[model samples]
Target chain A: MISSIFPSKNFFCLNKLSVCSDSFHLNTSLFYNEYSVILTFLFIATILSVIIILFSYILAVQNPETEKLSTYECGFEPYEDARHTFDVKFYLVAILFIVFDIETMFLIPWTNVLGQLDLVGFWSMIDFMFELSIGYVYIYCIGALDIH
Target chain B: MIVLIICIVLKILVVVVPLLISVAYFTIAERKIMGIIQRRKGPNVIGFLGLLQPLADGLKLFVKETIFPSNSNIIIFLIAPMLTFILSLIGWAVLPLSKQIVLSDLNIGVLYLFATSSLSVYGIIMAGWSSNSKYPFLGALRSAAQMISYEVSIGFIIINVCICAGSFNLSFIVLAQNNVWFVVPLLPMFFIFCVSMLAETNRHPFDLPEAEAELVSGYNVEYSAMTFALFFLGEYANMLLMSAFVSILFLGGWLPLVNLFPFNYLPGSLWFSLKLVLGVIFFIVTRATLPRYRYDQLMYIGWKSFLPLSLGYLLLSVGILISFNWLPT
Candidate 1:
């Protein structure tokens, strides 16, 4: 019964676990082999990027005047060098933005696998999050992220 | 095929979910650690010690206006973070947390990891170039240089591991260390690996690219809200990957210090998790303790210090193996 379910190849030995006896030979013969997966992803990414570029170009209205091309931050005339000495506040905000933003991305996958993980995964995540919160609070207290 | 699909799904479920949650909290952990180190109280508001802060922050970003600079190449700007985020996530596919638990237990797992990590630089460069901002561009350039520089040493270190273990498979590497962790025999290589990890992940003392005082927000300066968040996620995820790599490579991943009662019965994945958590704590501690290094200082440490040390260690390991008749005689 187990053999019927799992087939001839043993799960423990991954090299022999594939459906075909000569899996490597089959893999070599296939046009899109396992090795090509990364390349395929790269190719897809490139194609998507090109498509986005073309789409943006078609939609964008380019009035390429000097001032228009220049940096515009809340319509302030390019006052001070772009490399002007800015307060650490700007950086703090940027760091905070990055830090918390990453935390949110994790919630989705965690929620999905919560059932299988049981309390172990849950407590681990909580502990992990708690440590992260400490960093946030530290940064906040140090005025790392404070704009004021 | 059905079984294969089930295995693949299981791998994804195991790797991706934990990865995301870990990345999220890594940020919070960084902040909190930095807070404690500086002798200040970290986030205590927003749901009992700022427990709900990450959620609230995510919501705020989701609703925030995404501003595109007029001169920026908007498409690349948008895609760059996504690229970084995706690439970061892919490395976990090859990382074997335990005996039977990995997303894609490829034969060339180490090579796959190296390849993906190298590819991540493209995202950083694209983010910088597309922003059309000098700071972002400079940051991107710095990142490109730094990543390439350290990557060589990192690759060499991994090669040394491969030589010692005689396998490219991560699980095999972990299994090879069953008798003794690599940290004992390959102490120098282990040290180099740790430092290389710091450089590879662009953590403090080596984070020249994102040096706030100099490069502003680095490559993603123009990025706002969730887009910015993606880069953030990618960075933290990369950090987690590095930490996990360190744990598995040197710390005898999932191998308890002493096989006590519950520890003996505990799942291998649990041990892997414990090691990972400890690794994350180390990351936080480093961030808390170390100040950012100067750009030249960062480069000096990588090239002058880590590179030579790792190469020397590799030679030492080779010599030891040869002397012991451990080489395929």
Candidate 2:
């Protein structure tokens, strides 16, 4: 009863027929080909890495001079570990630079489109510039950009 | 589908290659700009007008050995700069240089950009943590805090623009400014956004994360050779992206300037590119002109000043929209 209902022979024959088809074989090859692109990229990347390493080894120098190996600071005797905490002013100045820098950055595109905008764009930019100038004044009053 | 793929490939190549080249020259531009500001010559011997200097620097970095510290997490150290570099590039996908030239015009393009920019902080964090060094770790922490804080104000500023334009689509936002750019009604918000972008990008003054006199090159202190180059590229790319955002949001993306003379015939993309270059020059100028900020002061500016100002601008825009019957009710 089980053998009559299962039809295992027919299933096996169908599987064999499907496997033997040229389209199925071609499909498998296509799958392999797609995988090979990624494989090729990885292979190329690895080769490049090896070549760079080998090249660097040829040019790499070894210097025992204590000064040469020390953390760089304009040839002045490098005082203190690089991790030693320094003035907060340096960070402040950097932040202020970015703020004003970005403000001016925004003005450029507005200026480009200003002519087509007529009085509207012109006045708009004036207003924007005016507002930005306030921040500039504030920053200046605090002396954020002052390097000394 | 095939055409779309080709278009995408071409767009990526066009944007990425020129962007890489520009980033390289930006280093030279920065030096030259600084020199001019400080009254000295900068890097003149490498080539004509020091044009070949960036190439020489690239070669030097390429030849240099990448030293992975024994105590460092090698996998994360490798992945951090790549992450930052890739994220920096991702923002360009949405920016419309001309009417038809954008890579992807997602409806929520602005939000998508903000999301991508936010993810970049993780790269900084990973770089600091994976290095197993104290300065980088501190730098990363400062960067993470600064970025997250300023992002809120930036988000609020963007919301003000959205309120005014009544769209999240970047192209739509630009089109909404057909008669006038939002820079007029949203001047205050635009101002806040600019400051926020500066802090967001960790540019000078806000560069506490990589303070040379303090953190010794910050998160990428452990990085060298091409690995370091990727981070440098990512930074300049981020600068470009921020500039692009300003162009798109407030300035009107790719919209021709008021049909003046020969300028009308010039493509919108050329205008956008010109704007971007001007933005780079502005970045350099600021670097020349300004000093860095104290950490606490940075926080104060973001939270105390810019945040409140942005919130006020957002409220003001909303009030105007509602009063003008622009709202759907």
Candidate 3:
């Protein structure tokens, strides 16, 4: 079954995961080779979890009662439905996280190339951080992240 | 082709089996250590020192009744724990047991870990929303906000580590610490990283999601039997994963302590295990030691404190490296 799909062309060295170091003048193929093992890991993990969950589904005793299955909120009879309008602060925090998180993402490539780039690169990243701090300052003063 | 498939399966089993076993033992280890700290015996009767307790617990969960909330969205509810467990397992793929023994030393090993940990936000969100219960819903909300907040700081710390290493590869990150581990020079970042790791795993001082006093066991409040067990397993697995991450980034993954005669003689894999064990003990000790943080204080620490501290540290190190020409090639 597996043989037909993989057509045996120098299978991943049975000994080691393909080294995709930055030093390797990386082509796209080498990158794919590095990722092949992860696909296997994911497949095996999904299958294993499914089988385990299904096993419990099958072998487990079935004894569902009325109140036992009801949504629990401190054993009271219950109030209205679970969903209700709550604080908008969580939403605000999440929105701000997205903006700052993207700025964090931009720093990754900047950091990776830092050693190779000259003093200009360092100053450029410093400038970027300065702008980000300004945004942070604005958010702080506006009380966007304040709980009170 | 069959051989290749077999090899991959064997590789997965090698890492996964031991990992699952350790996660199992780690539960007992946690109980035993916490017991000693609090002055009592923990789980000693189950097996030779509670060694067989996890296996027994697994069997018990397998045969127990799984309760489905009548008011829940059944599909997403069922999928949540599965997602959590799967996310935890997949992160192990890129962790280098030793330099030669990683399952996948992907170029983006650091980001792969980060991304998977980030995706775990969904499992909690799904479980909370789908359970259709008030407590779980509240738990989920708290969890999402908390996770997203800490992750920002963690991302900065990781960026600093990656910059220091000059590569995102986990192996390269480990090897970069050959002369002096990051913990020594990057000491403050190391501390912040540890604190964030605790928050990231949703453990002590920051376990706001599962805060029993208010949230009533939190998102898994309504979950029972094997479904509940999946959440438990996933959480422990994540702790193990975070501990391993700390070792790789700061303590020097698979590096023996002090390259002198006695320490250098030990194999790299053994050194890695020792460091990983130390990390797990750190988790347990912190759990035993600290009380939970106030939710508002938690948010304050994540944003106002760790974020700027890490950001400043990032620029400080970057400036130092560039000025001194100390950057790794």
Candidate 4:
């Protein structure tokens, strides 16, 4: 049943239990600690966070007020819907972040394999860095990152 | 099967319970320390030295009626704080308490932490939009953009650390520091990471999100009762998590300072906690001392300053490593 839930190319071994094999194989290269540990942690965290919220939710008394329920605008009624309150600057910030962020993402895998990549890999990444830096310099010159 | 399930659950509980407890105490500590800086008594009325203040605060928040805005989108509003709290806690699965004490010794530990921290923005966006309020929406925009901007530089900072340590695995990063902590060599990068960390966590000097004078408590302006408590908990938890990252990446996490008699006499986990406290103190002191950066200046520093600086440092460090044939495996 466990094997069907998280099928792996190799045995999915927890700390000691090998759910995918006949016997526990501690030495199996297929240590699923990394793979499933996050799933377990996320699962537990979700349950725990929800439980903490619910413990309060269940214990709290419900008091309803129309005035309290209205959106807060410091004693006055909201002049405009918050959703309609848009800033064009934020969109630019978001766009610029996504562009450079993806560029930086490429560095992660490169760093992991840097030793095997040798000097050729070194210069190539440096070249890429210069290219990105030029683009960043251009972005800065144009005041793309600035907001009032 | 039953035994395995029980064991997994137990291990998770061990990590999560202490984390939650420390987050509670972390709030109390911040208040107490901040009060001392300002020459006031901070929350000493509860249990001895207000150690139980967080619990009391939790109980008080829990008992109050939750006020949901009539104009708000109810569903996303509910999910937002839950998402923040969960994401904050989940990063710990990859953080090492000691050499063998990690919940997940994942090869991509750094990446996992990066992803979780980045994803935290969505919670704020969802909450602000759903609240249908003025300040929260504005606060959310500032915070979300601020976090996103700083995260780009933080990514480069991690690359700088990874180049020195030679693995995305956080444990390898820690163990690689046995001969010397990354701080001594990468002090500039370490300082940049700390500044970016402050912006990332929305703490003081960069806390435009909750610049109460302007934002009136920011993106969580509308949240009340337990939901607000979740955001509070999530913020502190993120602070704790970021501090742990600093310790692991730069301060020789879990490794004894000098590995000498007194420091080594204490356990590895204890050392890790001490470093975390150091980080927390740093956070509080910055909060007390530094004035909040204006929103525009905050953007200027994140992009124009830290971003360029970190990217250059990553390039230089990697270049140096390659030239010296010293890339760690």
Isolated chain A TM-score, each model? 0.43, 0.47, 0.74, 0.73
What fraction of the native alpha-carbon contacts across the interface, defined at 8 angstroms, is recovered by model 4? 0.80
**What is the descending TM-score order?**
3, 4, 1, 2
Which ten contiguous residues of candidate 4 chain A have the minimum total lDDT? Answer: A9-18
Stretches of model 2 off by over 4 angstroms after superposition: A1-148, B1-7, B327-329
- Clash number by candidate, in order: 17, 22, 0, 0
lDDT of 3 by residue, B1-329 (tens): 88887988898899998998999999999999999999999888887888898899999889988889998999999999999999999999999999788998777789899999999999999999999888899899999999999999999999999888888889989989999999998999999999998988899989999998898898999898888988999999999999999999999999989989999988999999999999999999999999899999999999999999999998888878887898875
Candidates' lDDT values, in order? 0.66, 0.69, 0.87, 0.86
The CAPRI-style docking tier of model 4 reads acceptable
**Candidate 4 lDDT, B1-329, residue by residue in tens:** 77766777789899888888999988888899899999999999888988889999888998998877898999999999999999999988889999799877776788889999999999999998899888999999999999999999999989889889877778888989999999999999899999999999999999999998988999999999989988998999999999999999999999998878897888899999999999999999999899889999999999899998988888778778887889874
In terms of lDDT, the poorest run of 10 residues in model 2 chain B is B320-329
Superposed model 4: Cα runs more than 4 Å off: A1-31
Candidate that scores best on TM-score: 3
Candidate 3 chain B, run of 10 with poorest lDDT: B99-108
> lDDT tens digits, residues B275-316, model 1?
888878877887777888776666556655665566556556
Model 2, span B27-101: residue lDDT tens: 999999899889999989988999999999988887776666655688887778777887887677677888877
A1-148, model 2: which lDDT tens digit per residue? 4443233332212221335556656445533433233233334334434454446545655233454333334447544444446457546744654564365345433322222233454455457656866786687577653433
Error of 2 at B39 (Å): 1.1
Pairs in clash, predicted candidate 4: none
Model 1 lDDT, residue A107, Cα? 33
Per-model i-RMS in Å? Answer: 14.5, 13.5, 3.4, 3.0
